[model samples]
Target: MRKFSLYMASICLLFGCEETIDVELKDAPPAYVVDAWINDKMETQVIQLSLTQPYFDSSEPTPITGATVTVTSEGKTFSFTESQSGSYTWDPATSTDRIETVGSRYTLTVNVDGNEFMAESELRRVPPVDSIKFTFKEERNAFQPEGYYAEFLATDPVGPGDTYWIKAIKNGIPLNNPFDLNIAYDAGFNEGGNIDGVVFIQPIQDAVTPLNEDLDEIVPYKLGDSLHVEIHSITHEAFTFLQQVQIQTQRDGGFDEIFAEPLENVSSNIMMMNENPDVQVIGFFNVSSVSGRGRKLTE
Candidate 1:
């Protein structure tokens, strides 16, 4: 069992949140896997490089070491040194300046093992979470307990296509199950509506609550429960990738699986710099701007 789910942990290279999910590969030959994404928060940023392994060989993904990784924005380049196996880091502790800025374009360059890959992303803006509030549900259904349920209040900026990944953190842990993953378009889900510049819609807002371990039931917060909500502004491409992932990785079993579409690879933004068109890389790179709020559920 890996630490967490979503493309973020396995991919922390996924959303790069220091959590990882269990992913099993099929009978394909090994390919380079780049789990790289970054944020505008002033902290140590990371990019992970690895190689895909056998489906049954579930120790850990083999690390791709000794790679030169750098991110350049507005002509200034920040180098990431390999801090550990396959994981590279750029610490801003020495300097007060952060690497990325909102609306600025960023370029990623990776050179290793006679292969070079390049990618580009823009640091997008995020709407701030005004507050987190919880309400006590007096009725206990078969689905959930009679306790406090939490939701955050924050309006999407007055614009279209403002995609966001809403992370619901309870206590000290992230509710990062594959089913727990929640993303929004504008102020809602993909319903083909112009729902911008408003607080997040019901389903999207309600997703802050997580499901049980089996992913079969909802778990509400209780008295004294700590609730933290974060909005990670992602690219439209990253949004689409997550959309596909949530669809593909959903745990709906039985008849659902029978009628499900054949599994295929999700998309990636990382690509080879040279014309070695045969090599396939998996993963994405997005420069995100995050906004958040936190508090506890009290009586």
Candidate 2:
């Protein structure tokens, strides 16, 4: 009788171990990062299917190796070849060597490791320059009783959000860098956080030793001084961040997984105008808002 009982107990233990080791199924697709951009000096150009590695929180970016990417437009097909693991180059000879025009639509298809991805975007057009003007600001100084500030005002007649870049040239030679003046604040409850402003600090040169008695010898910004203000063509980093979050959330399953993405696209686009390149416009501005309220905190 004891032998019989021992045999039953052994059978139960063996079955319990098998049950604990049962296989579980996961239905999630492999995550990937893809960065597509137009090459420098060419506005109508697009270099697509460049696989960026998965970010700190993102799934590994989809690899471009052995992947197929094609763009079709106006009856012409352009193909991209993966030159390396995550980067693909277009062959101008066979690819459509053309510029994407503003207001025109384009489609792109990418197949990586048998997974397909696609998107469409319009070549945006910026409004022509209406006017570039400046104004003076007043502030009290810690070293002096009073101080004067110089500020600039720009308009498009059409309104704000047209991206603009500022470049300033002082004393003849063209400055090497461009300054971006658009300043954005984080969304806060009380201040609306949407109010836009510029912060500028001027550098004062020391008076020459044994200098002349003329304290009124003044230097002024002259007209035709080559103040290069160019309309910026790059997509705003904020837009890119929001876009990535939207895409990741749509693809991911868990709530915490969806919230792990970063909130910055800070690619030299958010710098003060008074620094290195002297304050010239290299871009335009176009302000837009996402209509609905953000996701609820309770859920």
Candidate 3:
């Protein structure tokens, strides 16, 4: 009996001392992200903005519904209608039928779920093109098996340092794609918002040499030809500040910093085909990615 007792005690000691244990770690908290893109298609008569709902966790984003959205721009106000699948629509009228001043600024206001946001935009005017001429230059590129030269030119009354949208018309049709380039201002202050300059519409992929393709298709401007040009407004400075409202005991980084960045500038222009009146100009431009700190206008 004593030997059996001792054996039992030994078994209990071994088993109890060798007992297994387990533990599990909790996962990290999820993050939040939101993005808004301005629709390029709707520019003149209407401005459409699309908001994206980013994931808060590993799971898919839950739809945002029953939220009121309003936008104000250029002294005009518009509201959004909840469309299918997280889409919204609105059209705000401007103060005048014509586009605002080139340097004049426009403001955009957004409201969602008791939270508000704002963005600013600038309008730039397209400088007039003085003349269209051509020049010859030698080029050495492997892609161009044949030794070629470039010939193309469009002169603006104002020199470089300005942005422009250039287009061409061939055989009574406006070219869908026109080469867009920035002019370099030579020694001028870029003052008064005008520049006289020259630009060459080289053959596809040949910047130095104009490819001998369809002359009507390759050339953007012809001698003594009248062309259409457009320059957009721009804004370099942007900022936002947050306001705090105390609620529960939890002191969440009150009035913390949010998005602090400038938006991308945009411009569009119209080019006329002197020879082809049948062709028309259909173009658009706008700024986007507008984000900043949310400060109550009333506050």
Candidate 4:
């Protein structure tokens, strides 16, 4: 009986144990990522190119080198030279004739290896920021005490569909987070809002206040801190893309997980001109007329 029991125990140990299974995840093909922007300043227009990395990659995206980039505007063609790794820049200082003006249409063409991509944007004018105001609020979150919140006093153009991308610069550092991304359509929160030809509404004005990334709460300003506000006139397409990006960032992981929208890629203006339809291009190209105002905190 002991020998029979030992034999059954040996069989159970050999067959009933957990086994590790190896998962072979197929590698996704790389896609070209283009982060290209042009403002009314037009000193040195830049376009950055890189290849998308895998989902689990913690490192920066791989930059694509040795590409031909060109921009055409006002019946003239301007070529860009590689100033750094995967970055192409066109300096108008070398030739004063290559200025980017409002209402001018600019076209970008890129050729890398055998793949080609093209995009076009028209510069739109933005309303000047008359002034900026701030208010101190009592403790709203347990993480921190009272903080300063900023608001803009600018009138929207008397036209419908006038979209904008508002950026905050605190002490020379740009507040670049999903929460800091403030976009308004026709002086309202978004396209659905009918407010126009007036000062920005309360919600739109309050959205520009900077927030702490680590604590995920509104950050108060210190004495002598400089706050600069920049407003960029952007296309409706660009506004939609940024809105989607904000939604994606906010829905990453929270109580709203069940109400999150379906995952979708950020729309890009660049189109593949090559015959290979399988090759994909990502990111956006934007041309904006920027207006800015700055103030320092005294109290």
- Candidate 3 lDDT, 1-299, residue by residue in tens: 65775466556665764433232335433211122223222343333333323223455444444445444456555555666444454533422333333555444444444443454455444433333333432333443332222222433334344332333332333434212222222212233434344333333112212223332223323333332222222222211000000111113231221122222212212123233433222222233321111111110
| Candidate with better lDDT, 1 vs 3 | 1
- Candidates in order, TM-scores: namely 0.88, 0.38, 0.35, 0.86
lDDT of 3 at 291: 12
lDDT of 2: 0.36
Against the true structure, whose lDDT is highest? 1
Give the runs in model 1 whose Cα sits over 4 Å from its true position. 1-26
Can you write out model 2's per-residue Cα lDDT over 114-215, one digit (the tens) per residue? 455554444443333233333232433432222221222332223223222222333333333111122222111112433222221111011100111232
* Ordering by lDDT: 1, 4, 2, 3
lDDT by residue for model 4 (23-61), tens: 354678999999987776646788999998776688988
The TM-score of predicted model 2 comes to: 0.38
Residue-wise lDDT of candidate 1 within 1-299, one digit each (tens)? 33334323334443535543455655877889988888877788999999987757778899999999999887687899999999999888865557556889888999988899988888888998998878888757778777778888889899798888889889989987899889998998963878989988888888898888877668888787898898998989989989999988875775356467767788999989777766777889988898888998776
Q: Could you tell which candidate, 3 or 4, scores higher by TM-score? A: 4
Candidate with more favorable, higher TM-score: 1 or 4:
1
